[model samples]
Target chain A: MEKPKHKLLSFAYFLESSKVYNKIKKFVYDLIENDEYKYKRYFDIFMIFVILSSVTLLVMDVKRHIPHWLDDFDLYFVTTIFVVEYLLRMWVYSDIHKIIIDEYEESSYFDKEVSYYSLFTNIAKNKWAYMVSFSAIIDLIAILPSYRGLRVLRVFVLFRAFKMLRYTKSLTGFLYVLKNKKFELMTLLTLSTFFIFIAGIMLYVFEGDNENPNIHNLFDAFYWALITISTVGYGDIAPVTPEGRIVTMLIIFTGIGLISFVTSIIVSSFNERLSVLREDRVVQEVGKKKKLTVVCGYGLLGRLVVKGLQKEGVEFVIIDRSEEMAAVAYNDGYHAICADATKGTIFEKLGIDDRISHVLCLTSDDIQNAFISVNVKSLNSEVYVTARCSDQEIATKMEYAHVDQVIMPEEVAGMMGAVYAGEPVAFEVLLSIIEEKEKTHINEIAIAEGSFLDNKMIGEVDFERLRLILLGVFKRSEESKLGEFIFNPSDEFVLNAGDNLVCIGYSTAVANLKRKM
Target chain B: MQIQKDILLFGYGTFGRQLYKNLRSRGHKVKVVVGLDDYVEVESDSGVDITRINIKRNDDILALNVNAAESIFYCAMNKTANNLFLVLTLKSLYPQANVIANSNSNETTRKLKYAGATSVIDLYEATSRRIVNVLTKPAVSMALDEIVYKQNDLQMLEIELKENTFLEGKYVSEIKFRQMGIILIAIIDKELGYELVFTDHRINHKLDAGDILVIVAKKENISKFQEMLKKG
Candidate 1:
């Protein structure tokens, strides 16, 4: 019997001293610090719901009588959770202390391993520091018990709602914005205070207790001044004299302007903060997408490309050096980052390298486009690049840089002129195709491995019956041979599994073909 | 057709002045229309001449005798929307006259075309195309340059054969383009849904009725070819 007891005690000692303790401590630390943990995220959501309901019950209890059992049940349940969270946080801090000591030792910050007594003292100091932290104080207040019949102590229960602020990133960002604009806000506060004080003194001097029976004391005058300045006008106090009335009118107008000024300051700061948050959201969203197009410029050509991509429902991010242009793109419902695209790290920062399929450099400047092309290639060599060049020299240079396509607007225009001069009707048809204004659309439909069109002969399929014209067939094979484009193949031509049919037909007919494929 | 009066040039910016000089050098009379707010007297860079006219109202456009002028070139400043509006207004006024305008993008080019621009010169695209042509397709570009820039009067014509035409069932070699001094660039087979065949297949491929021929030759030769095919 004694041996068994001895063994059980030793087992308990081993559990406490083993790495299992540290692993469990790390798990709890992750729950507190990392929101990516699935269980932790669910727990956080559940806790938020519980806190909200508890606060609502507390508020309701103030106005009406709540059942004692329900109130007690809520208070006890939330307080118990709060206590457990607070203790867990403290335990994690202790684990952090051990980690710090180990790091210090590894770095030779201390010449030797510290004595047990010294380590204990250091941990005690760390614990003391954590106890005084703002969150820790709030946690303690949340779990504080209210004595029975001590009605005033129950107000501390509302402190539970403040815990929600810790989990809300946007609220913290708002607080940060407020802190950044503290000087401006303080100036407004000072101006309003001086105005109120002066107005209160003038009102008291113009209508003292002798003339106005409602005027009781200096504090009453100050209260009336505040109410008037806020435009609340509770109507509990009034000035009888004309001078006081004139002063009140002036005060009312000043209050109106000052209030608007304060509101404008808050609103502008909030908007600035919101843009920053939106930029972060864009980064996060880009991370989620498996394929994206990064447009490096927001000029006329860039805007046209963006519009086309938007019509096709393609995911893209616009990058421009001009803040105004970026803002314009953003307002136009595209994710835009205002940064120089020449910087190699910008792509990494935006996670553009993760799954970027295309990099379109459409800046007006040829040198900028070249730089962007090179940077994108260096960042991800597999990404296809298309750039706009102003001259033939730049086009050759871009081509040498392995850019897939170098477009020159002037050269294309000259070609268009030549085409117009040579074949006017054909030119119009081409223009209609590019403009997508014609009822007939030239669409490419791929034949899947088991598709109905796969392995079918051209003459076997009745395209005439469907009102679709097969313009070309691009056969892509697995052996890495260049795809062959058979333009208007013979009736005996066989359709392969990997063939992409470029058809010209009405939009409805094309849709039907797509459905059939 | 020779113009009796000077040509009217609208919007005397850089492009306008360049057009004025080019027309003047080419022995055509030229007049420039500046904005109403512009100074009446302005010096040219060459210090040889200055010509300016104000355009404040619609009558100003009419006063220029736009219909009688050789052509009106709207090489205004870089305001595409305003240029489009100007082209629309000009087209409304003189629907029969040739009015060429400059555009920036493909979209604007299409808009300008619909707005009745006789020839829309997208300067960027034109320059790019010229550069690309000079670099990649020198031979074709040289021919196009001669026709487009030099005004060689060479024509590109498409002819569709009728049923029972002599060309039916005849190989492309039988047409004898070399003897006729014409180039058969491609054949558009109607049976193949108008697919363009431009390879050596045209050398021995049997021609059929309703097969459209895309050929490039002088104006008179095209008509001669058509008459000979009709007689056959």
Candidate 2:
């Protein structure tokens, strides 16, 4: 499936032939469009700074006298950067030579001469698409004011503020909210325009000529109608006639109606986005943590898992459909969001494939857990997913979906009952130990590279003196994941770096041993 | 030492089957009762006795004789209504029998208790607690799996101190359980209404007769300790 890279023919592939040129072009493309690139974020911040400073200099020039050097720096230095940015954006929009050669190579089957003309159009189309793009137009006009030839268009420098939209995300979110309600806004705009036109004509008829000195002409009547309908009521000119006064009341009432209608539309748009904003905040918080566990339910089981995870100091997000349940987790100061977790695309939205180390499907409904585990495994095959099922049939389905850990609560409860009946005291001891209520724990501490415990033999550290029992060691190697647990390791066993020491002790003893790790 | 009791379990589902296996493996004679329509999984174990009856009729349940059973489990995790009715019927039938009901939710546990189940095992809470342990305390869960479920030499036992036992009248702080190759978690005092007073701290309480001590140790060490208690 590998494509042949050798260039066969002439000047059409000349630019593509240079590997360095292609490499540089790809880097610029990444800077311009790739959201994951580190330099792209830095580039955005620098651009934002340039736009802000340029706008600030312009504002200062309006009243206070800015230094000439500062003015020249703003007018020339900022314009050059804007021009360079525009050119780079246009260049990265599409690879011109690749398009030309690809079209030429394809058209060799048909009309070769016609492919030349088509190729010309193809290149023009790509460049023109970039040229007329909203951001592109803003980039161009933002720099045109610095040209001595375009002094008449000097006011266009304010477009630099519009350029700020390209860098900031929250500003773009505002535009998205308005764009979603475009249809309703347009209908309202049409209705208001119709009322304004009719009111302007009615005012002209009621107060034309000597009937009212303010409404001498149609322009004046229309201007009065505009001011009255907007609820501005400049009162520079008033209609003295009784008919015109009635028309004024109608215009004022219509303004109030349109204002309320517009207010409702905008308010509803924000209301819809408010939930999304909270979800986004949770998503952003998840992105910050190194190891994240995404629990898709906040019921009783979810609360139990959350408490254990909290004690372990693990970063996790709680997602639930019920507001009160999610609120229970949210109020507890954990990252929680009220949203349905069974949606197909929800895992990708949560960025589970990247930072999530575990996905817990703890919803009570078996079918819900199945759907969630399937979604999680589909998104990230490597992520360890644990799902709780109530029965054996659904447990089979969950395992079939490739869940890493399929938990049957009934089976667990049955085992608990048997253990309790057989060894009630043992069950109580194990339960308290598992729940960590008695400050006893069986914990694992990883030996980091260059740590004090690294390269030390197991016998060197006095685990007995530390009041802990060494259960085993989990050595991680590049070949295997998490490695295998070596049970009852010999005293002469050398403790290497990146080995996890599994021990059973009180929490303080574990903490003491971990101090060396 | 444990005197294995006869366990009578009613219902046929995942919970019932699982509990059946668990109790049977613990050397207890288990009798499983299922409805006529129940699909029972085939097992050839001689220790189990399965019977099919139309449990829908209250007279059939009333006529059912489980007088020999000391321990009864009502596992209607699939049918909450059945557990409620069965627990009520059984409570009337055997007033002093130990009836343990397995329920999927907390609310069901409460309702089963109201119907006179001596104890209700919350299926959700138990499983969730296990899962939490598996995730947060992997080593602990692994150790339990090795010794407890795997039936190894090392075992956990709860010893109820008999009158004039070795541990009687001794403060909890006076004993070093770990030196005997045992881990002591708590002491449940019968006089204090059976609360688990953790031994790690708050160790001022005197160990009384009839108080239960939860400890984990090897089988031989446990037997030796119990022998010492008997001779005390």
Candidate 3:
């Protein structure tokens, strides 16, 4: 019997469904961190979508604004889906005991207590949760008191469609404004309400007589005071007495200060959110996604290697055990996973056993490389491995492990020392230039078989016109005997078909050479 | 003694307090630090005794300013703008001082180095160095690189399930091979984490997109596993 196609498609479906949940989580984080009223813009957009969808569903269900029909089934179906969603959220929360106690055993007591707070904050944090949560509330609003007689609330479900606007950038900006200035605005609101109350009471006493029709009771006085403070003078309520007129004049001047205070609060709030939004957008745009390359130990030598890789535009992931060092890397916009590399669990967590292409072991200890080389080969034999060793013994052992390359740091260092001693002027000149100007880097290009230089000799290649200096030629010929160091040879030294020419010059010079060639 | 190429100083205290410690670490030659204080003392690595020196005089500054060993790092943390002013003023007074200051921005690196830093090294680059360090020593597999494993006698197998299949009960050790190979490491069983470590043995663990199996054998043995799914 053939296996069910659904069973085969289950994994893909599972991933596809989880994508929505992941997107929701990302949206929430963006919402919390968003500085602008981008949330509000998103909310507006989602609401529009919701409204349109609702209208279509309603039109399909009712056909006419009359009583029930077969079309009414669509409204019931959508409402039923929403109801199931609400139940699932509550059901997911029911497993809270297992989720917190089982999953978060290492968490502190305060973290456990605040874990509940995380749920609520998470609602405010994500775009979908923030939207769907409000939508969920609206869903409840539409579903409860399920009597056909109450049609108005059901119609309000059409407005609930606007809830989808939670996904848009502007809605996020709006929410950001609300979130950041919540306390300040709350204070301003309390003061405004209190002043309105005081004005209301005083006006009620001062304008008690029937001379002023608008200021009949305490409620009317509040209405007038609210209008005046808000700078919206409807002129609907006027105080007739001389004392009442003086109070009104005083209230009008207070309006200016109140307005300025509220405006200032909102502008600063908006500015803060706007800046954060821009920063998030930039990070998201710049951060590339590739299978992570886990760098285990970061020391002096490691730093240079990393800098070179970064310059060459390689996407690599880093794992350093040092907390302070990790903080610095993270601050610089590098995704650094902090864990011990020697452990099998870290490699498993990083998904390196399957996805990795190469492993570079450059720790100070040669023994560690020898050991890790074996582990990496055992884990994934197809992966290429390179190790750094100062000890020749360990280097030989590493080679036995099939390490593609073994770099000897001590040997390189000795070579450099000898070079400096023998050619002090050359070494000093290079170091001074690198330190002083930080300009003019080197480019080493190889001559390919198809190139114009296939049969040409050194003197005929127009080296100076290309504005490049041929430092050396790495000849690969059975007839001749030069490997990587054939320097300043005679003009008759033919550029072999597979010879690699090492040229050192600035980037512009290399570009000009390529263009000319 | 060879001059240290790159040295990082954490704090900017009195020149004397930092200078002597640096001198002891660097030996006799002048040392520079970024800070406002001036007390020089050379303490043992044991951190038990302290020797103080009064080098507040102009001679000391001039000596440190010109010494080839002197690479001063400004350690002030409170206000970056103030730190810039202090560093630039010191540079103007002593153009020979190879000044290195803690900076928050790229613009600051340019301005400080231009103002007169022999060369400005970002303390953050130390952070960058840490990342570089990690990259250099990436988590590597031992078996894949070893000579015992690399010879034709050994092979590494990474089997991924394109579709779900029931093959859990069969012993991996008993699996027939097209060529003689050994099943040394099984990654998929461990990747599910500690919960499924050794319990509820159904012998048939269904494979998924994330399911990975690492097997080792001779070169000829791997083709058998590949052929089970009908490759050739």
Best by DockQ: 2
- Tell me the spans in candidate 3 whose CA falls farther than 4 Å from its real position: A1-48, A52-135, A142-148, A151-162, A169-184, A204-209, A213-219, A264-288, A291-311, A314-425, A428-517, B1-232
Q: Tell me the lDDT of model 3 at A328.
A: 61
Q: What are the per-residue Cα lDDT tens digits for candidate 3 across A1-517?
A: 1244234235435544577755764565454333342574564454355446555766665654534553354456545654664564443333223333332343443454324455434444443443356545665664542345776665766545544444455576777687788898898888888878877777778886676876667789889888887879898987788987887787777777788998999888877665356435533332333444545556555555566457656566555556555556566676555555666765654456555655666565778777777877777787767677766677788888888767664343222222232222232333322222333333445566667887787768876556554544667767653344454455677886666655434557766655544
Give the clash count for each candidate. Answer: 17, 0, 84
Provide the overall lDDT of each model, using Cα atoms, as 2-decimal numbers.
Answer: 0.68, 0.76, 0.51
User: iRMS of every model, one decimal?
Assistant: 10.6, 4.1, 23.1
Worst 10 residues of 2 chain A by lDDT: A1-10
Ranking by lDDT: 2, 1, 3
**TM-scores of the candidates in the order shown:** 0.63, 0.78, 0.40
Better of 1 and 3 by DockQ: 1
CA RMSD per model (angstroms): 10.6, 6.1, 23.1
Please give, as one word, the docking class of candidate 3.
incorrect
Kindly state the fnat score of candidate 3: 0.01
Going through the candidates in order, what is chain B's TM-score?
A: 0.51, 0.84, 0.34
